[model samples]
Target: MSNKPLTYLAFIILVLGGGLLIGANTMPGDWYQSLAKPAFNPPNWVFAPVWSILYVLIGVVGARTWLAFRRSMAMRLWFAQLVLNFAWSPLFFGLRDPMSAMIVILGLLVSIIGFIAASWRQDRTAALLFLPYLAWIAFASALNAAILVLN
Candidate 1:
């Protein structure tokens, strides 16, 4: 077994994680601070670390799926969810539109489910890797909806 593929996976994971970190830099700033959040809203400091870990996990799953089944629907769904993931920050923070952000996140949730289902047959590990992401996004979607309602 050559290590070449593992190296490539690591490289891909790094790139994807970096991209997510960059995208996450679109912060909420004063606008977010002023909003009426739910009682369960986590402290501001919690988001960075949580999202960072989630992104890394997502990257690992994406790399695994790609390695297991390149150009397959599983990979496509993975990519699609990633695109939606990247879109949320801009829609919510940059544009300051929680309603639109909620829509995007809902789409992301769907895409993630699709990715997990597609990956299950090909690679159970990859499918399992997405569970945390799905849970987080579900939480985020609820948060987005709550923010939309509160503000």
Candidate 2:
């Protein structure tokens, strides 16, 4: 457990978390508040904390995978998913298009699954770390679909 890898991990985590924070800061504002939400919609306050946890988990998984496998396909998929994750907020909130956001989420879900599958052989811990992320994204996909339908 060298401090070097840990340092890299911390840097990766901060970068990923920063992206999430930037997205979160771009509040949907009145446009989002006026939308017809589904019955299951979580309160607006729920997103920040949940996403914060998920981003940290994602960063951990990324660090582990990178430490173990460098720029492997699993790492690539992880990066791909992160990019898609970053894209969702702007599309859904900034652009105010739930439909397009749903599309991005779908891609994110696929990338996440791919990352998990690829990471499973390389590092089970890393793969396992993604499970909660997968679950959350699944829930998010459903939420996006519901918003598209309701709005």
Clash pairs, candidate 1, are: none
Q: How well does candidate 1 score on lDDT at residue 120?
A: 87
- Model 1 TM-score on a 0 to 1 scale: 0.89
Candidate 1, 1-151: lDDT as tens digits? 8765785568456746666665658767899899999988988888877887787778777777766687899989988887888888888999898888888999999999999898888899988988988999998888898888888
**Tens-digit per-residue lDDT, 1-151, candidate 2:** 5776676678466756677676767787999889888888898789878887787778777777777787799988988997898888889888888889999999999999999899888798889988998999999999999888887
- Candidate 1: where is the Cα deviation over 4 Å? 1-25
Query: Over 4 Å off in model 2, which ranges?
Result: 1-9, 12-16
Q: By summed lDDT, which 10 consecutive residues of candidate 1 come out lowest?
A: 11-20
Give the count of colliding residue pairs in each prediction: 0, 0
- Indicate which candidate wins on TM-score: 2
